[model samples]
Target chain A: MLRSQFHIELNNMHVELDKMCHLVIEAIDRCVEAFQNHDLELAQEIIRNDKAINDVERSVESKCLSLILKQQPVASDLRDVSTALKVVTDLERIGDQSADIAELILEMDEKDSYLMIEHIPSMARVAIEMVTSALSAFHEHDIQKANEVKKHDREMDQLFEEVKLELVQIVKENKDHVDLAIQFLMIAKYFERIGDHVVNICEWVEFNQTGKVNDTRLI
Target chain B: MENKIVAKNVNLHYGSKHALKNVSLDIKENAITAFIGPSGCGKSTFLKTLNRMNDYVENCKIEGTILLDGEDVYDEKVDTTVLRKKVGMVFQQPNPFPMSIYDNIAYGPRIHGIKNKRELDRIVEESLKAAALYDEVSDRLHTSALGLSGGQQQRLCIARALAVQPDVILLDEPTSALDPISTLKIEELLLDLKDKYTIAIVTHNMQQASRIADYTAFFLVGEMIEYGQTKDIFSIPKDKRTEDYITGRFG
Candidate 1:
């Protein structure tokens, strides 16, 4: 019942949430690196690390529940706890998408040439930055950085379109490798999805800061 | 808000001690409004002002308008008896009268002069049903109310309040003394009763307020710190002091 200890528990919740964020960030970085370098060993590592991401997300959620039951937080304190609750959901999905990308990378046969292989890496880099920047914004309460994540999302979307266009060109011209080009498109789609999850984390940060969720509009 | 009772800039004093300070809010009709705060923060004092329950305190002076149905309840011409009849109250302790259940419920209508045997019997049944106590105690109508469980006794108190057919009910910590299941039943009973009567309850149980109340007001140091829909109050309290109190940060 000590105020200091209640706050300590609250701080512990934040630390756990940050830990989950870092885990997902690592998954994104390594998943893309394994894909770019054609490193099947690293791809398998990311796929295995998916279970760890789920465990951290589950642990953060348990911590949130404990804080609510023990401390009964309200106002901004309550907001922070609930926001952390939501943040982990998107983080878990980002983790899953990374693993999905890695799984696809695992199944794809080695190819000397693939459509948009260079472009997909660019998308992955932007997506990784999005996740990394959004987590930093949330940890530091930086609205400007969160906004920048939203702005950068457009680039991720455009790169996805470019990959799709190049896939279509490959399918039209050299139908022999069309299936591998389709896998590249799927990877680009996963990277775009990772960007979307980062945007969601930014929106959750806005909710934590102002207690206003962007799920509705008042106009 | 379709308010049933309105307090406007209400102030109360216990001799020189300012007990309630410039409090104002509406108790919406057919909805439960909960007043929550720590001890001596004026939540209970303000709840009493709604039904003029504070009039019993010696040297208590009230200086504001409380209107029920657009009529100033504190007007010189307003009869306190009729006022009390229109606004019944349930207390913290399950203070069932040391009498049979039938008599405990019939006592209110008898004092109001409904002496016909069948009429009083019907009123007893109706009030008991309204309080969700009829099924449990109908067979033991003649048994002493003090013999019932603590939860039943509290519901009997609610039945006694309902017996008067009051338009508004003021409860002071009605479930603070009961177990979790009993507390849940009381909360369910309150939610059901709010459809027929406007309710204002003062409670220290934060979850109880959130569960049943449509609106909530947070009191602190004789001041109304925050007032809003229960969802807003719990999820996003505006004042730092209100936040502290709810978040268990305020001592």
Candidate 2:
């Protein structure tokens, strides 16, 4: 087979993997919106519907692994599949983490006032945007965009630290809210980790395309 | 670090076929350099050239020079036997001699006329210990080397090479035939030996190359595609062919 044909096939598979990333991100986005509005019904529904995102992660992983094992994909193709594998693993964990937050949302009653309600959803949005843009960079093979993702991760890290501080203050003020605040803090931390993972995936995309692995912030 | 054996503009041919084309590599003293590529890519052929093992093959001709410790190994005055003694080799399969472990370790030393039993015993013990296997087989040195496990046999072969006290050791897919545990043992042993012996290994396993080698040379279609530090080669290979091969594109 011609090299161009092999490359075209790998490009097609890359698009499919990108679509899978989109699916999981959209799922997490939905859960984020649900948790923000204290919509227990919607949060519960998102928790119940997480299987679809999980399924995409599995399918994409299988596709990438098969391409690697069978086609012996060349430079860019190998990078794409390897990045897809790591990204899907990260996205899958994000899906579960979002579900965890949704479960917390389900337990809280409608009347309870969150310690840092304003910060949590906004933090989630930033985290989601980080993943979204990182995936966009990967899909376009844009190193500049990946670098932007790295920059925005700083915001997520700062927000995580702020939230941690606020939760600590709330726990000290009212021990009754300690459990809820701790759970919320864990959710925020998971989102922060998700952001970090997205940055990692972006680094892989750069490494795949340029053969360079960039060192990014851990948080 | 300066290379003990340096190959400059090296090329090789097997009959009408080119096996290596313009491959220039520097293997540092007391460092492990791994050559990785797909099958039939001339990694083994290149490894064989270091000690002129290809001299045994008919119609196999080489161009360019290989230097050993700043001296030309391929020089007409340099005895191939003497060169082989300075550069020891271990093959893919552990072809232990059809003799006991004692004889296997003693074979080369004995050929060189080291007849003192006490000295031979010390060499055997030290070589086996250097290969990290003295304690397991010190009591059973009289047993046939083949009777040991595959990993132990491979280590015994390493001990045999160490007994010769070579300056450089070439491993041609030495762990390819062994189990995972055996592969790990050999890898660990190589790591330990790197501080004392200049080691060159040809392997198809990229992870192995990354794990143990200080320098990695990627070969493709009888050409040196890229050669660099292992971290740089794995993380950011300059050549597209290198990136393709290391990331598991083609064999």
Best by TM-score: 1
Q: Write the per-residue lDDT of candidate 1 for residues B1-251, one digit (tens) a residue.
A: 69899899999999999998999888899999999999999999998887888889999999989999999999999988889889999999999999999999999999989989999999999999999999999999999999999999999999999999999999999999999999999999999999889999999999889889999999988999889999888877778888778877776
lDDT of 1 at B112: 89
Please list the C-alpha lDDT of all candidates, in the order they appear.
Answer: 0.88, 0.83
Candidate with top lDDT is: 1
lDDT of 1 at A94: 97
Fraction of native contacts (fnat) of each candidate: 0.56, 0.17
How well does each candidate superpose onto the true structure, as a TM-score?
A: 0.91, 0.70
lDDT tens per residue, model 2, B1-251: 88798899999999999999988988999999999988888999999999999999999999999999888888899998788889999999999998999999999999888999999999999999999999999899999998999999999999999998999999999998999999999999999999999999999887798889999998888988888888777766788778766655443
For candidate 2, what is the recovered fraction of reference interface contacts? 0.17
Off by over 4 Å in 1: A1-6, A34-45, A68-78, A102-118, A142-147, A210-212, A217-219
Model 1 lDDT per residue over A1-219, tens place: 338887888888878887888889899989878877778899899989999989988888998999889877776777888888999999999999999998998888766333345577689789888998899999988777788888989999998898888788878888897778777878888889988888989988788877765744111
DockQ of 2: 0.15
For every candidate in turn, the CA RMSD to the true structure comes to 2.8, 6.7
